[model samples]
Target: MKETYEEKINRRLKVKQRIIEVAAGREKADLVIKNATYLNVFSNEFLQGDIAVANGLIAGIGEYEGEKEIDVNGKIVLPGFIDAHIHLESAMVTPSEFAKAVISHGTTTVITDPHEIANVMGLNGIDYMIESTQNLPVDVYFMLPSCVPATAFDESGAGLGYKDIDSYFEHKKVLGLAEMMNYVGVINGDGDVVSKIIASQAHHKKIDGHAPELSGNDLNAYIAAGVYSDHECSTFENALEKLRKGQFIMIREGTAAHNLSALMPLLTKQYSDRCMFATDDKHPSDLLNGGHIDYIVKQALKNGADPIVTLKAATHNAARYFLLNNKGAIAPGYLADIVVADNFADFNVEMVFKRGKLIFDGEVKEFDAPSVDETLVEKCHNTFNLDEVTPNSFKVDGKLGLIGLVGGELLTRNLGFADKTDVENDILKIACVERHKNTNHIGVGYVKGYSLKSGAVATSVAHDSHNIITIGCSDTDIAVAVNAIRKAKGGIAVVENGEVKALLELPVAGLMSEEKLETVNEKLEKAKAEAYRLGADKSIDPFMTLSFLSLPVIPSLRITTKGVFDVEKCELLKDEMSV
Candidate 1:
């Protein structure tokens, strides 16, 4: 039996009446925290009061009696942190596992983009992510993937047009369209891209942006197309320019892209209101070692940032940006998402409460896993369309353009041309095999700065398009690594001397694992050790760095299933380079 709409309204009205009664001191609150110093986001100051909760909502924040009370005499209470943008799949774990890892770190909400898995299974992938995150302690909202294949040059398993995802804007958990990586298309008024933007605008939803290093009329045109926020600003000048153009800047500090230090100057009172913190893509090791939004907040505090301003950026700014009005504050009629910490200096989170429920003290509260459709699970497990590859599949006989890696950045450089693999000078062979349709389309090229002297590394977690990207010194090791990923259905593999040295199987859409965070981090650590042992640069994260090489939307040079791509010109390089 289902409650009628009128009955539902009446029930909510009764709850609201109770909240009013509790706030007016006529009725007892369900729970209350006494002796608290909570952040007043509206005024930007630390105020002392008792926070009362009833019916999973903040009843009041003053002296109040309750059924249960917890005393925190000297602790600071805050609105639980909200991650402005992230990709849960990048952690290489299921949504449930991801929630478990972040809850203890005091992240009560996360706005994610399923573009990574969307490229693999399309609508089904998006559905899978939504279904899996239901009923979790952490509120996991979404921005519907705007660029499924990212661009026309890439071969993703599925392509999502405007029509394909227009209806998703109506979903309760979906905030709006995700990062519009195809800024070129939007500026040029590509019909499909424009249609998506118009649909999101029609629904009055926020459209996230991803135009890195764009400036002048191009940036204005992109903003004119209704893109509201960007997470790809690498320089402070770039972020400031975008900020002046009426765009919110999502300062990204992730496992790979470290843009926080460069943009930390924006954390001042002048710009903090329009700025938010986002990890964009965090790996398992980083999550376990550092934390989530708490990590970002702590970093800002250590760098002499104003504590209240930084805290507001972590909660209020993001909540306001995404239009979650009830969140990011500890006011009456707001959700009772709260965090208790020792102090601002150490920033040690002691307990976390989501919707008035104390879900984390030292250990995370256990809950049932969100039930996903078994059929969808099966489909995700069978994502790899290619069966196998041989040494001959990786041979590229021509003058090759090399992708030079910039340390600690997603930006790559075009290092002119190379006639062959220069292993002595730290150049290695790289390839992106089409694993979606098995067209046997393998784009072979060379990369400098990885400095792998022996074995090969391969993964199914290539960005934008989840293709099987492998790099090695020899053709045999590269083939063996690719075949290992294919045989495992989808995973990352390390090979040397025609044998697998280490592997981390991502059975879920070949992008994430269903395992817990600790297990995935352990396996990833093993694989990383092997990569470093084989002479991978110790300065950067090897696997995470390799995964971004095939992303064509970033800049300078990239590779796809077609061949070496010149992103600025938007064409595949052929005979333009000679030895």
Candidate 2:
């Protein structure tokens, strides 16, 4: 006879409890940790103590007696870091693989926005994320994608309406609605936007906001519309306004944007309660080097913010805002998800515990995560059409507006009229190729200031839409870059002087890889190195900047496969210089 899901869970819990009781009698705990200095995010205090775990929850924490007591005499114990906002797909690996790398860095929980996969595979993709993370030691909660394509102007792999969101909300793993990328809809009072928020609220879920350019009247309107948290504050004034308006300002540090330093100034001991830290979209390379939320905490401290305040933002604030009662604090009854680090500044995670079990002791241990099957791999086969093929397909006439990428910020500086009539040394080209729907809609336009020297860079990792964005000096390289991407299924590729310089294959939905996390990290590092070899010396991972170039939701200049867009006016134009 088959057992119900509830019954299975109950049985497991009962077994876990039984094991704990038996272990206690023997004066032996499943895991006995001693001499650990703990960071109390709740009280903002540090205490030298011992934690005892029997089953998967904190059986007891204080001075404890256990079967195996490993002395961590010189380590500072912290509540496992919680990433308030992240797209797991952006890591270029599956949840299990992503977990392995972060666990060592002391991140035990992730509040993922699977909007990337939602755009490509919809509910099925979400289901894949849910199922994959079920047995993993790390705790991963999800927010239902608020905006499918993120904007009405751009196209995506799929769409989820109110009913779709309502149905998904029934899943126990679903935490709240993901960032509502439709700021215009909220401020403008679009019926669809209102309805989605209402649906989430009806289910007692929190609404996440994504107000990129919103300020003054428009920003006020968004808050009134029920967005509780926002991570896109580009300036101190904007962050302050959002915080004052009762929204948790998630100071984001990610592959594309690093705003922790700028936002760190706002984190006073008093106001630190309303701030949280998140990796909005961390690529494999960044995750391996800097870490998940660990990077944010380190940067915050380096900027002269209080260590405990930064810790509170990373753990307690994020957990309390998301209403995750079971984890985030080192309190009785909370899940035994804790990290042992020597210092808060360095954040060297010596040992990590998720649900009381030692998942990572500076490395992966007995991590039996499931393998990615056909569905996860099959989801990558989005329609790709090349029927509108022309040798010089991305050629554009006259001057165009250039969407200038500001390193380490979500905000783009909109440069208007960058070129006039495609001057010899001032010509910039932006091309968007439809990667999902095989549409021959390859929108091309001239852009200025995004200086490219005779080569093309192509990526299917375009944000929200996951389309192919090709920018180059030569039309031949642009075409080669786009065609090369199609042949590899889905990935980011750079072609210069008729040779492929770099590529990162995202086999899963053409946005993430199904490979191991370490493998992905290695490839990502190689890709970045190669990009540098090909003259991309602007940012740490310029591929992330490349991905955002096609996101039309953000202000200033942007391009979709349809055409160049004035994000402020939300209109497509023939050229950026004309703007």
Top TM-score model: 1
- Output the lDDT of residue 183, model 2: 87
The digit string of per-residue lDDT tens for model 1 on 304-384 reads 999999999999999999999999998998999999999989998899999999999999999889999999999989998
- Model 2 over residues 313-418: C-alpha lDDT tens digits? 8888888998888777876567788888877556677788788777787577877876555675565454344443444676656665666666566556766555
lDDT of each candidate versus the true structure: 0.93, 0.77
Instruction: Tell me the lDDT of model 2 at 402.
Output: 63
Q: What lDDT is obtained when candidate 1 is compared to the true structure?
A: 0.93
Q: How close to the true structure is residue 546 of candidate 2, measured as C-alpha lDDT?
A: 77
The per-residue C-alpha lDDT of model 2 at residue 236 equals 79
